[model samples]
Target: MVLTVSDLAVARGGAPVLEGLSFSVAPGEALVLRGPNGIGKTTLLRTLAGLQPPIAGTVNFPEDTGAYASHADGIKAQLTVTENLAFWADVHGADLVDSVFEAFDLVDLRDRFAGTLSAGQKRRLGLARLGVIGRDVLFLDEPTVSLDGFSVKMFASWLRDTHLALGGIAVIATHIDLGLDAPELDLTPFKAAPDARGGSDEAFL
Candidate 1:
């Protein structure tokens, strides 16, 4: 499995949020996390990305898994769009190429300074980082939060197309549904643990 979760559980403020949750994903697939607010969707994604350790359980990745999480400020504010991408490319040890610019639709903005770009533009640039790297699995949390409808559609389309083109695994946690082309694992219940206590409050504590 490109990604695997076994008996995962998490707690915040001394209360368990997710328990006994397990799932797996392979290449050329996209998994979506759907849930109400404050239900641990982001927490699960963070755990899967290895940004947070689960209270109990295990997450396994392939030996060469390349991963990126949201809110990392992938772009260098002091640099132009191309410059920022080049920096990431260098970090990932990837060959800088025009395809990364074409993948994220940033060709026109390549010469523009990253700091002056809008939030949606910056997010798109961040997504473009994947194209520059050779990661087998990709993780994105709320990737479309600041995007307008047009940009959102563009990104969804791009994501679907890229999965097909590269045969990679993409896991995204977003409230706005992308209608992805791959199987989606809705994580709401796993996050909330609706059946965790079996309707009894006595065991919750």
Candidate 2:
């Protein structure tokens, strides 16, 4: 799968956040977004994932081939870990629930209620859904949040084994370095200037 973004512009609260950005990701490739907070990395990911419309430019990718994982995790609190994975597996017609559990070291927590899990555990469960869905293009936002060092390494290994190995494309927005040598886009150059409500923005001036 290939994802092509041409001169993309993204906004927040009716104000542009990122502008004149463009890139492409081929199958088996990963593109990392790097910048400080509030630089629109989240917005750019959301726009590419089709969760929000871009202010300008084009994002071209096959329909239904993309999956997005935000920082929120989006787990059903009352559901068991396996139950959550099952729901998505059913939805996406993917039958890798057990494998995903093993991938994230959740085999022991299969029957545990998501509500009872700690923050890092829930984050793992949230990310595990991506594996179950089996989408070709993944848009991830701060995917390493609340994870310990080992878990982070495990997550990176999974990305290497499953997604990239299968010729999938990934666009990740994160501050932590997962040690992947993927090409990076620093969003500071693309940040939108503050409007008249703020003082003259030297970056744009």
Candidate 3:
């Protein structure tokens, strides 16, 4: 499947931040989003993931093919690592895939309560949710925050050797390079004018 964004415009706090942006991601491909902080990488990802409506243009992709992973860990602290993953898998109408534990290095902590895991572990669990669900397109923002160098490499390896290798598509907004050999889309030129399209309170963050 292909993911396409056409002349898209997105706003933060009712004021536009990005506009007239167009791009596409083919199967087995990933697009790295690059720009200074607050440059609307998150906004654009949200728009593409259908989390919010774009100010203009369109996002076209196959149905039920996208998953968005942001800073939010979405971990149920009360539950164990396995249970947390199981919950999300079920919610996405997918089986609790055992491979997720291996992918994110959660095997040793499977029985540990999510609330008790270290910050990096929690981050791993959150990211692992992406694998648990059977989606092919990923929209991720700062997926490596709190992760150590080794964990980051593990995540990168999973993306390159597993996800992309299996025909998955990803659009990630992260400063660190995952070495996926993917093309980059810098949002610098797509920055909107200071007086773009609104003066309301729906800021992009």
Candidate 1 clashes between residue pairs 3 or more apart in a chain or in different chains: none
**Given candidate 1, what's the lDDT at residue 179?**
69
Ranking of all predicted structures according to lDDT, beginning with the best and ending with the worst:
3, 2, 1
TM-score of each: 0.85, 0.92, 0.95
Model 3 / residue 150 / CA error / Å = 0.5
lDDT of all predictions: 0.75, 0.86, 0.90
Candidate 3, position 75, lDDT: 93
Greater TM-score among 1 and 2 belongs to 2
Q: Candidate 1: deviation at residue 94, Å? A: 0.2
lDDT of 2 by residue, 78-138 (tens): 9999999998899888896467888898999999999999999999999998888989999
Q: What lDDT, from 0 to 1, does candidate 1 have? A: 0.75
Global local distance difference test of model 2: 0.86
lDDT per residue (tens digit) for residues 1-205 in model 1: 4788898886554456777788888777788877677777666776677765677889888866758567655678999999988888898799878877876779999999999999889988887877777787888888877788887887787778875357778788777878686666665657645445321122211
On a 0 to 1 TM-score scale, where does candidate 3 land against the true structure? 0.95
Q: What TM-score should be assigned to candidate 1?
A: 0.85
The lDDT, on a scale of 0 to 1, for candidate 3 is: 0.90
